[model samples]
Target: MPSVTTPPADSLLQHRAFVAFWFARIASGFGFQMLSVAVGWQIYAVTGRAFDLGLIGLVQFVPSLLLALPAGHVADQFERRRIVLLGQVVEWIAIALLTGMSLAHGIHEVGILLLVCVIGIAKAFEFPALQSMLPALVPAAILPRAMAVSASAGQAAMIMGPALGGFLYVAGPGVVYSVCGALYLVSVALMGRLHYEQAPPKREPATLRTLFAGVHFIRARKDVLGVISLDLFAVLLGGATALLPIFARDILHTGPWGLGLLRAAPAVGALLMSVWLARHSLQQRVGTIMFAAVAGFGVATLVFAVSTTLWLSLAALFALGAFDMVSMVIRGALVQLETPDDMRGRVSAVNAIFINTSNQLGEFESGMLAAWVGAVSATVIGGIGTLAVVGLWMGMFPTLRQRQRLHVEAAAPADTR
Candidate 1:
C-alpha cells in the first residue's frame, strides 16, 4: 500500500479506482438498507412480536463478536481487494438464496432468520476489510476527507433505500429482495475494476496469540481505548433507531412519509456535517469535540423524547445525527492514526465489533426498556445514561481533554511494555 504524505482534495476524485469503489459502495449500501427493511417488515408481519424484531438485530451482531478476530486475521493475511470482493460474492449469494426462499412461498420464520444470520456473517468480514483499505487508496493527510466522502455516500443511500424499500414492500417483499440481490451483483462487477498495489502477508503462524496481541495493543493505549470506549457507550445508550417505528406510529402520529422523514433526519444531518467536514478537517481539539458532540447528542435525544410535533422530533433527530457525526469523525481519525499497519486488520476488527455490537445491544436494550417503561421513559433514560457515560469517560481519560488532531505518522509500539 502506498502512503501519501500530502493529499490534495482532488486526489480522490482523480483516482478512477477510488471513484469506482465509492460508487459501488453507495449502490451496495442502498441495496442492503432495502434488504433490511424488507426482511424486518416480513418478519414482523409474520410474528407480530417486538422481540422478534430485536432478535434480528441480535442475529446481525452475534457474528461480529464471534468472527471479528478471525475475519481480521484473514484480512491481514490476504489482499484487501480480494477480501472485499469475496464479501460481495457472499452477499450476492446470500441474497439470492433468500430471494429464492421468499419466492417459493413456503418460507417460514426460521428460514428468514437463517438468511438474516447469513447476511450478518457476510457483514462481519466486509466492514473491517473495507475500512482497512482506506489508506491504500488515499494519502494519510486526506484520510479524514476520504472517510467523510464515504460517510456521505452511505447517508445518501439511507435517504433513498428505506423510502424505496417501504414502497416496494407494498408491491412485494420478494420483488425487493430480488432487486437487492441484483444490486449486489452489480456491486461485485464494480468492485472488480478496482486496482491496487498488493503484497503478500507475513508467513508467521496465524494464531489466537496474534488475535490476543491486537486486543492487548488496544487495551494498553489510553488514547485508543478512550476513543473506542467513548463510542461504545455513547452509541449504545443514545441510539434510538430501534424505537423509531414505535415513535412514528404512537407519538408523532404520522404516516409513512413522516416516518421516513423521522428516519432520514439523522442521516440528513450527518450528510450535511460530512460535507462541511470534508472542506475542513477536524485537526484541532478532536477529542474534546467528540465529547462535546456526544453530550449534544444526549441533549437532542432528550428533546426528541418530549416532543410531539413531527417537525420538532425531526429537528431533534437531526441534531442527534450531527453530534453523532462529530463523534464518528474524531474516533475514526484517532483509530487510523494510533494503530500500526500490521495491526490494522485486528484492531479494526475489534473496532467493528464494538461499533456493530453496540448497535445490536442498543436495539435490544431500547426495545426491552421501551416495553417495560413505555417508549418515552425508555428513550429519556437512555439519553441520560449516555450523558453519564460521557461524564465518566472524561474523568477517566484526561488525555482526551488536552488533545489535538491525530498525527498520521506511524505510532511507536504504544508503550505496551
Candidate 2:
C-alpha cells in the first residue's frame, strides 16, 4: 500500500477548477439546506403532522432512485462540466418557480410538495455529475483533501442555512425561496468557470445494460461492496434526522431555532472531525476507524433518544454527526481508491441509489414507527438497529476489516501508477 500524505489546505484553492467546483458546491448546499428547512416547517405548520415531513424525504429519494442510474450514465458519457451546468439550471428553475409562488402569496401545501419533487429531480442528476467531476479537477493524491474541504464548507452552510431559513421565514415566507433561487444562479455561474480534459465516450451502450455493469463492478470487488453495504445498512437503520421537528417541538419544547440547531448539530460535529482527519491523514486502520465511528453514532443516537434536556440532546446529535463523518470519510476514500477511473461515474451513481434508498427508507420507518409506538421508542429502536448493523457488518465483511491502507499508488492512472 502506498503511503497517504496530507495536502496543504490551499492545494484545492490554487486550482481554478477545484475552486470553482468547491464554491459552487458550498453555495448550492447552503441553498438546499435552507430550502429543506423551509419546506419542513411549512408543511408541518400547515398539516400539523409528522408523517408529512416523512413524505418530503420520500419524494426526494424516489427520483434519486429512479433517475440516478441514467444520470450516472450521462455523467460518464457527456462532459461532466456540462452535465453539472444543466443540473444547476434545472435547480435554478425549480427555485425560481417556488419563489414566484411564495411572492404571490399563493403558496399552498400541494404547490410546495410539487416544488419539492422538482428539486428532487434536479438532485437526481446533480449529485452524480458533481461526484464524477471531482477526479477531473484535482490530482489523485489530493482528492481526499478536496473532499474534506468540500464537506466542511457544505456542513458550515448547513449550520447557517436552517437557522437563517427559520428566522427569514418569520420575517417573510418568501425570503427562503428567493435566497435559494439566487444561490442556484450563483452556482450556475461558478460551475461555468470549471475546465475539464474531455474524454471520448465509452464504447459501452448507454442502457440498462451499462447501468447494471456498475452493479457488477461492485459485486466483483469484495472490499468495495463491503464498505458500501456497511454504510447502506448503518445509515438505513440509524438515520433519525427527519423526525427532528417532533423532538424539537414536543420533547425539547423549543421552537424553530431549536429545530434548526437539532438539524445542524450532527453536521457541525462531522465538519470538525472531517477537518481534523484531513489535516492528519488516517491512512491505516481505515476499516477499524469506520466501524468504531458508526458504533459511536449508534450510541450517541441512543443517548439522544432518551435525553430530556435540549443541551443533552444537542450533545448527542453532535457526537452522532461527528462519528458519522468519520465513516463517510473512510467509505468515500475506499470508493475513490478502489474504483476504476473509467467507471467512477456509474459506480458513484449506483452507490447514490443505495444511499438514497436507505436514507428515505429510514425516514419513512422512523415516521411510521413514531406514529405507532411514540417518538422516543422510535428513536431508541432505530439506534438499536444501527448497533446491530455495525455488529453484523463487522462479522460479515472481514475484507473491510482485514484490509489496511488504501493502495493509492496503484489507483493512479497507468503511467502515474
Candidate 3:
C-alpha cells in the first residue's frame, strides 16, 4: 500500500476552485435551510396538522427515489460543474415562482408541495454531481480537511438561515421565498465560475448495468457498505427534527422565531464540531469513534424527546448535531477514499439515496408516527430505534467496528488483510 500522505500547511481555502465551490455550497445551503423553515412553518400553520409537515418531506423524496440512478449516470457522463449549475438554475426558478405565488396571496398547500417537488427533482441530480466534484477540487491527501472546512460553510448557513427565515417570515412567506431565490441566484453564479481540470467523461450508454454500477461497487466493499448502511439506519430513525415545528408551536408554545432557533441549534453544534474536525483528523480507532458518535446522537435524541423546556430541547439538538458531524465526516472521508474516481458519481448517487431516504423519507415516517401517537412518543421511539440499530450494526460488521484508520490505500476490503 502507498504511504498515507499528510496534508500540507497551506490552507484548503487557497484552492480557487474549492473556494468557489465552497461559496456555492454556502449560498445554496443558506437558501435551502431558510426555505425549509419557511415551508415547514407555513404548511403547518395553514393546515394545523403534523401529517402535512411529513408530506412536505414525502413529496420532495419521491423525485429522488425515482431519479437517483439516472442522475448518477448523468453526473458521470457530463461536466459536473455544468450539471450542478443547471440544477441550481432550476431550483432558483422554482423559488422565484414560489415567491411570486406568495406575493399574490394565492399560495395553496398543493402548489407549495408541487413546487417543492420541482426543487427536489433538481436536487436529485445536483447532489451526486456536487458530491463527486469535491475530491477533484483539492489534493487527495487534503480532501478530508477540505471536506470539513466546506461542511463548516454549510453548518454556518444552517445556523443563520433558519433564524433569518423565521424573522423574514414575520414579514411574509413571500419575503422568505424572495430571499431564498436571491441566494440561489448567487449560488448559480458561483457555480458557473467554478473551474477545475476536466476529467474525461465516462461516456457509457445508459443501460441498467451502467446505472447500477455504484450499487455493485458498494456491495463489493464491505466496509464501505457497512459505513453507509449504518448512517442510513441511524439517521432514518433519529430524524426527530421533523417534529420540531410541532414541538415549537404546540408543546413549547413558541412562534416561528422559536422554531427557527430550534432548527439552528443543531447547526451551532455542527459548526463547532466541523471546525474541530478541520483542525484534527481522526487518526486511529476511527471505526469506534464513528460508532460512539452515533451512540451519542441516539442519546441526544432521547434527551430532546423527553425535554419540555425550550433550553433543554435546544441543548439536546445541539448535542445531536455535534455527534452527527463526527460520524458524518468520518463516513464521508472513508467512502470517498474507498471508491475509485471513475465510480465516485455512481457511488455518491447510491450514498445520496441513503441520505435522502434517511432525511426526506424519515420526515414522512416521523410525521405519520407523530400523528398516530404523539410527537413526543414518536421521537422517543425513533431515538430508541437508533440505539438498537447501532448494536445490530456493530455485530453485523465486525471489520468496520475493528478498523483502526480512516485512510485505506486500496479500495478492496481484502487488500487491508
Candidate 4:
C-alpha cells in the first residue's frame, strides 16, 4: 500500500480574514506611498527650502516615538480591529483634508506638516494593533508563509504607488491627493470587513510597569531580544538608501529616471523574493538562514556603495532587498510565534519603535556622515558596521544563532543555550 500524505494546508488567501487584511494592506500602502510623493512635491513647490522637507520626517518620527507605548497599551486594552479602523478613519480624514486643501490652493508648509503629524499619531496607534493582529489571522503552522504573502502586498504598493502618484501628478498634485483619498477609502472598507477574534483584555492601570511590559518581556526572552536587536542594528548600520540620490546624480551621472529605478530596485527584489517564499516555506535552519541573509544584505550594500554604474548599483540594491526579505520573514515569524496573545500588542509596539526609529535614524546617520566624509564612503562605513553587528550578535545570542526552526516550541527548549 502506498503511504498517505496529508492534504496540503489551505492557502492564506482562502481565509476571509487574511484576505481582507491583505487587500487592506495593499490599498493603504498604495495610498500612503502616493500621499507621501504628493506631499513632498507640493511642499517643495510651495517652499523651496530643503530644510522644510526635513521637517516632514522630523514630525512623523517624533509622534511615533512619543505615542508608541500608549498606542501599544490602547491596542492591548481594546479591540484591535476597531482600533485599526479608528486610526485609519483618522488617516482618511487627514487625506481628505489634504485633498481639499490642495484643490483649494490652501496647502502650505505649516498645514502639510500639521496634517502629516496627525497621520503620524494615527499610525502610532494603528501599527501596534495592526502588527499584533496577524498571528490570529492564520494557523500557527503557516504563519511564516502568510507573513511573506502579506509583505508582498506592501512591496507591490511600494513599487507602483509612487509611480501611480507621479503619473496622476501630471494633472495636478490635487489629482494625486484625490486618488490617494479614494485608495484610502477602499482600504478602510476592506479593514471594516476584516475578521478578528480576541478575548477582551483585562483593565489595567497605565503605569510605567504596565506600559513598559513589552520591553521587560523582550529582555527576558533572549531569542526575541536577539532577533529584534539584530534587525535594529543591521538596518541602522547597513541602510544605504539615503545615498541613492547622490549616486544617481553625481556618481552614476543619470537623471530622475535612474533615481526612480534605483529606488524601485529594492522593492522589486523584495517582491519577487516574497512571492517565492510564499510558495516555499522554510523547513529548517531558520536562525542561521536569517543571519546569513543579514550578512548578505551587508555585502550587497558594500557592492552598491562601490558600484559607479546604474545597472550595477541596481543589482546590488536588488540583492540587498532580497536578503533583507529573508531575514524579515524569519524575524516577523519568530516574534509573532514566541509571544503570547496578551503581550503581542505591546511587544509589537516595541518592535515598531525599533523599526521606525532605525529607519529615520539610519537616514539621518547616512546624511550626517556623508556631509563629513562623502556618500560613497558613508555607505561603505554603514555596510562594514552592519557586518560587525552580525558578528557581535552571533557571539552574544548563541540560542538565537543556534535556532533551527520557526516554531515557538522548537525554540523553547534550546532558548537558554
- Number of the top lDDT candidate: 4
- Give the candidates in order of lDDT, highest first: 4, 3, 1, 2
Q: 282-395 in candidate 2: lDDT tens per residue? A: 667777887888899999989999998999999999999999888887777678667766777888899898887778677878899999998899999989998998888888
Model 3 has an lDDT value of 0.88
TM-score for each of the candidates: 0.89, 0.87, 0.86, 0.95
Error of 3 at 231 (Å): 1.0
Candidate 1, position 365, lDDT: 88
| Candidate 2 CA-lDDT value | 0.81
Model 2 residue runs over 4 Å out of place are 1-4, 39-56, 105-112, 242-260, 370-378, 407-417
Q: What's the distance in Å from true for residue 299, model 2?
A: 2.0
lDDT of 4 by residue, 264-355 (tens): 99999999999988887776789899999999999999999999888899999999999999999999999988888888889999999999
lDDT accuracy of residue 223 in candidate 2 = 77
What RMSD does each model have against the real structure?
3.2, 3.3, 3.5, 2.8
Per residue, candidate 3 scores C-alpha lDDT tens digits across 306-339 of 9989999999999999999999998898888887
Regions of model 1 farther than 4 Å from truth: 1-9, 43-55, 101-108, 255-257, 371-374, 411-417
